[model samples]
Target: MLEKYASFCYDQIGSYILDSLDYFEDIRPHLSKANIQVSLPEYVSAMVLSSMFVSITTLTVLGSILMIGSGIAGLIYGMILSLISGTLTLVGFYIYPSIIIKSRASKIRDTLPFATMYLSTLAGTGTSLPKLFKVLSEVDEYGEVAKEAERISRDIETFNMDTNEALKNAAERTPSEDFKNLMWGMNHTLTSGGSLRSFLRERSDTLMNDYRRRVEEFSETLSLLVEMYITVVIVGSIIFTSMSLVMTTFSPNMSTGFIVRLQVLSIFIGLPMISGMFIVLVGGLAPGGIR
Candidate 1:
């Protein structure tokens, strides 16, 4: 359904969308690195169409509700909110490819050391480059590395590209700098009649060491995060609730209902929101495949 809508949007005004955006060409590499299958014009069209749809829907629903409640002032506020939402939606679509590229790079980096070790083993067995990638592509354990391998394998087998040419293309498009270097290294080794097995073994060792360092760094980060969680969410909530209860008890003029609502909001809403935010922060900071 989304594809059909995007296609329809593209067919209607894709040329105008493409011509209006000076940075459309600049995002091509990002799209390639992120492995987004849509063309630049189609993507821009989809962004424009989606933003318009969301803006119109928000305006109709929220404006009607607000208009009924607060007259013209509420309607004006609703329009402002709709505009903000539409702008944010447009910005989100614009940056989505970069986010995907970063995520893919992280996943690839996390899995590369083990995948390189596996490739070293295969290389030692005198397996050809295409065959090595084909085997890697079939292994689900490697995650994004496996998917990247599948692309390389497809380039060699299905596209009839030679190993060097395929590696070059992969290096050009890959989000991970380490993976790109590996491809280039392998290409050079093959061209120079050097030993593929030895090169891979050395590269694998380097990557493993880097991976261990990253894991140790994350361990330190995790400890700090745990301390923050306890301090800010647990202890802070308890202290705030205690203070609120004491104030309510001492101050006879304050509304008991208001105090009770404050306590409820702190416990039910604030604590959960803080905890959820912490969880998202930790997840984003942690290396891929660990959490």
Candidate 2:
């Protein structure tokens, strides 16, 4: 319903998107890769998201100011928060399609070696390029990459595009660099009279080695991150807590409110935000499977 409303907003609102077309051209490929269903023009999508977030943020800031404090200063502060929040919301909406593309790309990259191995094995049987993809597309075992191949096959068969054109389309829209390169390589090989099977097999082997090297490097980075987390969270928190306690113990005249407030601030405000940052970091680094 909210999605419909946003689209409606795009349609009913005169197009601010046309004036900002260049700002969103880079996102068009990602939109297809991410499978976002937007009937509106790319520009319209951006406009709708920005407008909606700003509207919501305005209401939220007004409510907060009314409920919590009142004055010119409060209004200014609230507007500042609203502007920041709204900007971030617009940024998130803008990047969300790209994020989805990257996620699918990660999943595709993780399984590219296996997918290539499968393709190589089929190519070895002397299957033509079109037939190979047509067969590959029917096999759901490769997951999202297989689905992508289906699109390629559909373009070639249903839309009457040539093999080269379909492959080019696939390469342009795929989130996976591996997949894009593979398509381009295959297309070039098919065009230039090279052996497709050997190319696929060699590519599969290379992709497998690359995946292994990345996993090892990622593991090493993870170890360093673990050490950093321990130092920052466990050691830092313990030290901070101890200092607070020691200060309270030594100062006989220390106010209980200040001591309690210090504890609350450290635990409630600091810890959750630190943990959240690490969580986002870990998730961003996590790409796909071990194999």
Candidate 3:
């Protein structure tokens, strides 16, 4: 019996060690990969989980304590509230990561055109691909793209991975189709004796034209959006103000708190939202074109 127990313990320990090793290997590449710079914060993940549990537990405990004074009816209500709170907490944890990832993807998309333009310029100037990577790495002002390029350059120079492999690794890290396509074309050019400089220039031209068309579309849409908002705000304000005046005439003793609240809400909420919409519209229209 002792021998069987020892054998079982050894098997469990070995399995645990193997699983940990596999996890480490998977994360090891991701930590240093080129494309995506930020890792999901381990501390934040832990804190989020802990806080969620604490919140539910605290709410449950407080409700239970209060219910003890009210007997069976309060106990039932407290249990329902605890269940609702715990469910909501679980859903929040599930949704937050998805939202954050989507937001990050949008930011990455915004940066891609600029990175492509930078790369195209280097490619067009008769710089070899590896040298272009090195140049981008050295360029301090280019932000995340520069950092990503530098990682690729490092992988190539230190590990002797071919440009294609490094680029493939980068695409995997980023998980962006745009980056993947660019890397694919670049790798093909490097390996197949094709003219990379011309390919890059042509791609740059294509992307630039598409970007310009998008800007034009956004600009045209903005005028209509602005008109719509102005009409809504103006008409609503007029109607609401006239109704309030009529009400005041009818109910002279009534407190004007509702009107004041409406006015305050319109000024605080509508004005800021409208301004934000305008800024978004302008940003889309111009984009500063990647600079």
Candidate 4:
């Protein structure tokens, strides 16, 4: 009886330790949330994506082997290594583009509202539309937008470019519709001699309202998504935990026991994370207009 009890205590302790390790593994990817920035060089970013592909391919193969209950063959298996290398090269191409798009979107989203405000204020100040942009470009208060605006301003000041040319350059650089429309409005006002201040004022108000509405909409959508995610995590945790219990009940020496366990680990543990990432991507891609 004492021996049985001792075995049960050891099993329980082992189970707890495994559970803790699993929990950490699940949250590890999201623990270091990277900020989207425009600092990295294109080539360096590509290299990083390549590295991620290589790493993920190796991990997948090792994981798949574990899942299939296949032990690696003797020293330096060429087939596995070659397969991983090919997989990495294939996957790396797609990963870099996705990362680049996401990063660009993040930076654009951050700079948008401020650019609207600056343009609005510049318009309201009775400066000519081109001069307004010039003033904005010179201002140091804004970060990325200021840098971009300064670039536009330089084209005007140094290149002696027309307002339309400079504005078009700005729009081309950012690839944001907000700036594109701003350029359009400036061009229209310049050509037609419309009230630039009124145009900017309307646009600024619209952008602010749209920004608020987008935030509200995203909050509502994300609240629902979060609820769904939590439900999935809970249900999945329960299911895998039940499976773990079942595994514990069965003979530990089964040929494919560890494989089954790892598959369970991937599904229950890895799936929530993959789901969360898709949710974040959806949120990023959701169509939102800045008035």
Full-model lDDT for every candidate? 0.91, 0.80, 0.64, 0.59
Query: Once model 3 is optimally superposed onto the true structure by TM-score, how far is the C-alpha of residue 202 displaced, in angstroms?
Result: 0.8
Q: What are the per-residue Cα lDDT tens digits for candidate 3 across 1-291? A: 423433443444444344334333444343333233333233123323444565678567867886789877777777677667766664654455445444434444556676677888877778877888899878766555566678789889999998889988777765346656777888878789988877777766776676677678767777887788777677777877788878878997866887678777877897688768867756654444433
Error of 4 at 207 (Å): 2.4
Which lDDT value does model 3 have at 149?
A: 78
TM-score of each: 0.87, 0.72, 0.67, 0.53
lDDT (Cα, 0-100) at 212 in candidate 3: 78
Every model: Cα RMSD to truth: 2.7, 4.5, 8.5, 17.8
**Deviation of model 1 at 16, angstroms:** 4.9
RMSD of 3: 8.5
Clash counts per candidate, in order, are: 0, 0, 0, 0
Please give, for residues 92-164, the per-residue lDDT of candidate 2 as tens digits: 7678887888778888898889889999999999887888889888877677888888889899889999999
Score residue 107 of candidate 4 by CA lDDT: 54
Report residue 40 deviation for candidate 4 (angstroms).
19
What TM-score does structure 3 among the candidates reach?
A: 0.67
Q: Which ten residues in a row have the lowest lDDT in candidate 3?
A: 38-47
RMSD of candidate 1 to the truth, in angstroms, is 2.7
Local accuracy of candidate 4 as per-residue lDDT tens digits, 77-194: 5345645675666455435445544454455555567677777776666676556667776766555556566677778889999878887766655535675687777677778988
Flag regions of model 1 displaced more than 4 Å. Answer: 1-5, 15-23, 62-84, 255-257
Q: Model 3, residue 10: what's the lDDT? A: 44
Q: Which stretches of candidate 4 lie over 4 Å from their true place?
A: 1-106, 128-131, 138-144, 172-174, 246-291
